[model samples]
Target chain A: MNLKRLESILDDLEGFSDPNIRYEQYVTPSYVAARMLHTISLSNHIEGKMIVDLGTGPGILAIGSALLGAHYVVGVDIDSSVFQIALSNLADLDELFVGQPPIDFVESDVTKCVLKPKSFDVAIFNPPFGTKGNSGIDVSFIKAALDLTKVAVYSLHKSSTRSFIVKKGEQLGAKVEVLGQFSYDLPATYARHSKAVKAIDVDLLRFSHR
Target chain B: MKLLTHNMLTSRCLKGVTNGYPLKIVANEVKTENVDYNSEFIARVIPKVDWKVLSSTASDFGVSLPEEPPADIESNEDMLRKVHHALLEIEITQGDLICPETGRKFPIKQGIPNMLCNEDEVK
Candidate 1:
């Protein structure tokens, strides 16, 4: 819709703080977000189609999709902060379009959030890997993600827990595919005690509910 | 480092710790700069954090934080400011996060962390 408004919202969001300072939260970098969105839109022919971003922090992926001409983009996150930011971002975009198709932000957990099943053309996220007292919530998040869209793309670590999500996705009858893997650096404050936690292989997984 | 990595990392690389719950952070070089933050993002992530890991790590980074996080912190600008600064400001520009157990070194270079070890040492 309104590209300028989108830019302004992003600019404003940059000053707040690292959103992921909470828990299991990793804000997808702009490059990763842009790259993932491009891959999903191009591979799935998502232009002019409905798109959703689950766990949509700062609404980057969802906003990026809308900017790329998605018919509609919905971002859902359990955190009110995330939803608020996304709502603000979308509102700005709507202002630009002068009453275009609205971008939606729903505040709900990925597992329990109600979705318009089979209604979304594409869904994207950099999901949490229930490692840090995650309560293993990502399992339900992935299920909800796959259930809500025709095609879903996610970024995840290749930990044992994440591997289960990938395996289960295949069993769910979706045409599951692992697209790409890249290592992302953790922040400096993290204790450099592990075996390099080679775990953070940002996987671009495509799930075709077709 | 991102809390995502903090949540999953263990000090097993250095060796001899039964529970490497909180990896010790000894930052030789630290840089705190402009990292974007959105309150909404933090709120959503609160449930998924490893609080023990975070509070301990924050202290290591020279930040004194709350042991228990308050809910509805979104409207609390003061609290949010602290959260913002602790997470986004304190950057580890160059340093080693030593494993408390194994004493292995994970190098941070140019704001990026290299956790890769040689082939022989992996096991």
Candidate 2:
């Protein structure tokens, strides 16, 4: 499917039914997901490739990978409650493709989950940026992805963390590229937000492990 | 849990469980469903899969895979079909995925494997 049609379909995907504050769960905008997929497709066709979507809330990235012709897609999330919603979303998109790759959802923590080393071609995630203590959780996801994949990682993070991510990528001996920046509209789900939507700048960073 | 997921999972997170890989499958229930076969996909995934674990797990689920994956998997259509059936078509409806090292049991219900562990189990 073309990028435009894919974006529309992804737009219809259900986000958090009930957002979690501690996990900092926020739905990744379909446009951003589409844009990243399009950009990645320029260098990587995605067809017949193994893709893993870390923290796959409702399987948006995972389903998107399947649609892009990834051979096998695994969506891992700590929460199991969202799997049903994700499966339903996949069902809706399954009709569009003749033989989409098998998509699997694993209820596991991204940091602790043991995937074969270099098992996947690409690891994609929109990891939490909030600092748990001294460090942000996005670094952990990047580290895990680097450990798990052979090719590259596509991740979403707050634009402010660009330098930290780049430094971490260098430390891990990977090349980091800022693919694109987009405004993320954080809908006021919590009581603290005075506005209906709080917009913030976020960057999509791609780390190539050669 | 599909064998495809099983092939990548390990229980190494448990304390002192080095090489806690290829979790043993103790399947209480198994189901087979038709999934569209893609030869290219199967061929591509074969190299990534742990063939020994896949073969053993498939046998436990009554889906037979060859003892060894074909050397030239890309051109081996028959082997690709078998791998496809083993990975995508068969699902473990209910079971306990036992850790090889710690012997901890992760439950599978309605085809979803709960790999979460207690705080104490986290290491």
Candidate 3:
């Protein structure tokens, strides 16, 4: 499927009904998710690849990867309530790729899960930006992804954290690249944000294992 | 959990477990469903899999697998088909994944393995 069609389908995905500040839960915008997947697909990474989506909220990235011909997609989330929403969203687009790779959802904390080392081809996640009290969470996610991945990790983080991410990537012996930048619409789910929608800059960082 | 997932999982996180790999499978139930086979996908996944662990686990489930993956697996259609079956077709409906070192059992229900451990189990 083309980017437009995939984004249109992902536009219908449900977000958190009651988001938690502790996890800094914010649904990744469909446009950003589509763009990231499209870029990865262009690099010849999506097809026939075992993809894992950590902290997959509503399974947007997982579904998009499956639509783009990933061999298998696994969506892991700590929150159980989002599974139903993700399943429904996946069911809606199941017929689009009749014989594409199968996608499965697992409810578990990403950090604590026992996924085999170097099993997955690629790991993708739009982790919590660590803005709300939970600092350094994104680093942990990147570390875990690197531990499980054989090729590369595609992550979304605030552009401001580039230096920190670069340092972390260096320590892990992976080369980090800033693929692109996109504006994220952080919906005012919490009362602190006075505006209905707050725009923030996010960078798509690719950490390729050396 | 399929043998594919089992091949990747290890019990290294369990308390006092060293080289906690290839958790022993005690399957209470096993099921198989027809899935479309993709030779290219299977070929790509072969190199990433732990062949020894997969072979042993498949044998426990009565599924036959070659002792080692073929050197020319990319071009071997029969080998690819066998791998596709072993990895994706077979499913563990219910079971316990026992850590090789600690003997701790992680229960599986409806094909989802619960790998979470108590706070004390965390290193």
Candidate 4:
């Protein structure tokens, strides 16, 4: 599907009703998700690829990848409730899932789960930004995603952390590149945010293992 | 979860557990949904799956596979279909993925396997 079609399909997906602050559970906008997947597809990785989404809140990335022709997709998250929502969201788009396997939503923490290493072709997620009480959680998610895939990993992060993430990914033996930038619209979901909507500098990143 | 996923899952990192592979399944509900048969995808994924674990686990559900993957799987359509079904079609809707070494059960409810453990369970 094209970018406009992909974004429209993704816009219909349900978001977290009570997003956990600890996980930095923010709904990735459909426009951004569509853009990210489109970029990955340009690299010729989405079609016929085994894709995994770590911390897959509401299954947007996983579903988007499948919609883009990923062969088999797995969506992993620690939250148990999201899968129920994800399944229902998937069922809403029954026509789209005609050929694909229903996402295997494994309920597990990304850092700890010994998910088959170097097995999947690609990994994708909007990992916890590692804020609040959870420090370094973004790096943890990046590391976990890297372990699962042989080809590449895709994610979004704060533009401020580019240097740090670039260094960290290289230390882990992957070539990291910044793909694009956006103003991540974080609708105030928690008690702490004083604004109705908060927009933050966001950078889309790609890490590849050749 | 599909066998394609179970083929990769292991609670081996759980504290004090050894050989936590091929998690034993205790199925309360097993659901089979028909999916498209894609031979090329199945052929590509075959080498990544452990035949022993997949075949033995599939046998428990009465879908018997051969003792080993065929010599030339890319050319064998029937074998590819069977693996595709077992890997993508069959699911444990409500079950427990018990770690083999410790018998620690990670409950699978609503067709999703929750692998998170209690505080003391983490190393």
Candidate 5:
């Protein structure tokens, strides 16, 4: 599907009902998600590939991957509460994906989940940027994602951590690239929100194991 | 959870457990549906699957498959169809995935498995 079409589809997805600040459950703008998935699709990495979305809240990326022809897609998260909404999102679009791989969601910690390592072809996620008390948690998500995929990982991190993330990826022996940057206009969904909406700079980074 | 997903999960998250694979399945509900067949994709992914786990799991749902990928898997349309069905079609709507080692139970409800362990149980 075209970028505009993809974004429109993602726009209809449900967001977290009770947003948890501890997990940094910020909404991923449909426009930004479309751009990230579109870029990965352009690179020819998604089709017929086993794809996993770490910290997949609302299942936007996971649902989008199945819609785009992924052979299999699994979305893992610590929050079971969001599974119903995420599953409902898939059910809402079930008619469109009658022939696609089964899209499954698992409830578990992103870094500590028991999913097999080096099993998936690609990993995509908008991991928490660790702005909360859980400092350095994004690194754990990145680490788990890199360990899960055989070829590459696509993730979003705060632009402020670009250098640290780059260095971390290098230290983990993966080739890292800054695909693009986005300004996340996060809705004041949790207690931390001072305004109705806040804008945070996010960088889309691709970590390739080559 | 589909058998394909169950084939990849383990209890390694539990403290003191290593290689907690081939999690035992205890299903309270199982659902099946037909999806468009894609042999090419199925053929490519077969190698990555744990065949022994998959074959045994298939039987639990009354869908029998070979103990391993058939020797002629690439061209075996009959086997591919069964593989596709077992992997993607058979969903364990409610169940428990027990670790072979610690026997720790991870509950699966409404088709989603809760694989999270308590902080104290985390290694």
Candidate 6:
């Protein structure tokens, strides 16, 4: 509730870690994650409904959803290390909700993970677009993401890949809408030289399942 | 650039290289400044890094590092110090990042990458 206490809670959450993990990447920037939650609440006034974050690295969106009043949230990813981070972050959010939604972090490929079909009211994901010098954009991940919710929002790279995802979503029978876009000037490490100096256009897209 | 973007980039723009699988680096502006280093953050992030790409890129910038880092490194002050430097110290302010494929130039002005493609490229 207080500023100092909130900062300490975040420090503890940020301090959490794990090894031997894969695919749990990109702790969605909190401001962006918060914005995503805002967009969902604005698009449809569905309060206290079940929500899920498919690739919930560090559980920022999942925890933000809980803080924003999602009755329940399931944050899924293939990496356990990221789950650990998410687990800690969600702890700080417990105080915000009165009988809040249980935020569960499952370590599994979202595509193979089982869900309450058509049960989730909203699903949000900031999937791993690129990894280890490789890009992981594909139809299967999108299909899997769409299968679990009535409406889904995605934070995606603004590239030619956007066209591919839109086409795929429409074929699967959801009205696709791009919500908003922003750019990030990511710093570079010694290992990665490109310095992600480009304006990484982050798009918020909605798949309105009719 | 963020590890997320580097992971998806290809060097298809390099002339005479068919796949251009990895783009080579020619960094003009490299600064090591204000980025913060949370050990927990680095520990969580190690798994996501493309070491091969990272090492090679670092090498281009004249920073030599091992391909496989030792475990239990947190206790090693020297190693942790180096990791800290590598992860958060460097900044890229002005330069041209070439797309390995298509040789598209994404310029970095004041540390911002302009990835805008022309109308023809967009179509």
Predicted candidate 1 versus true structure: per-residue lDDT over A88-154, tens digit per residue = 6555655444233324555445564233355465677777656556555665666777776665545
How far does residue A80 in candidate 3 sit from its true spot (Å)?
3.1
User: Model 2: DockQ against the native?
Assistant: 0.62
Model 4: per-residue Cα lDDT at residue A70: 86
TM-score, candidate 1, chain B alone: 0.75
Taking the tens digit of each residue's C-alpha lDDT, what string does model 2 give over B90-123? Answer: 8888988898887889998877788887768878
Lowest summed lDDT window (length 10), candidate 2 chain B: B33-42
State the weakest 10-residue window (summed lDDT) of model 3 chain B: B108-117
| Model no. 1, DockQ | 0.01
For A26-49, candidate 2 gives per-residue lDDT tens digits of 788999998888777777747778
lDDT of each: 0.57, 0.82, 0.82, 0.86, 0.88, 0.55
- Output the lDDT of residue B85, model 1: 61
Worst 10 residues of 2 chain A by lDDT: A128-137
Query: Of the true interface contacts, what fraction does each candidate have?
Result: 0.00, 0.68, 0.37, 0.83, 0.80, 0.00
Which residue pairs come into collision in candidate 4?
none
Which of the numbered candidates is closest to the native, going by highest DockQ? 4
Q: Write the per-residue lDDT of candidate 5 for residues A1-210, one digit (tens) a residue.
A: 899999999999898888888788866889999999999999998888899999999998998888888889999999888888897888788678765347888999987869988879999999887777787898898899988889999999888889999999989989999989998787675325679877878899999998
How accurate is chain B of model 2, given as a TM-score from 0 to 1?
A: 0.93
Model 2 lDDT at residue A176: 92
Error of 4 at B121 (Å): 0.7
Candidate 4 ranges beyond 4 A from true positions: A189-193
TM-score of each predicted structure versus truth? 0.52, 0.93, 0.91, 0.96, 0.96, 0.53
Residues A1-210, candidate 3: write the lDDT tens digits: 788987888898787777777777778899999999998998887888999999997889999898888888888887766776777787677567654237766656788757877879899889987777777888889999998888999999888788988899889889999999998778785324689987888899999999
Off by over 4 Å in 1: A1-23, A90-101, A152-155, A159-163, A188-199, B1-123
Q: Identify the superior model by DockQ, candidate 2 or candidate 5.
A: 5
Error at A174, model 5, angstroms: 0.4
TM-score between candidate 1 and the true structure? 0.52
Single-chain TM-score of chain A, each candidate: 0.77, 0.92, 0.94, 0.95, 0.95, 0.79
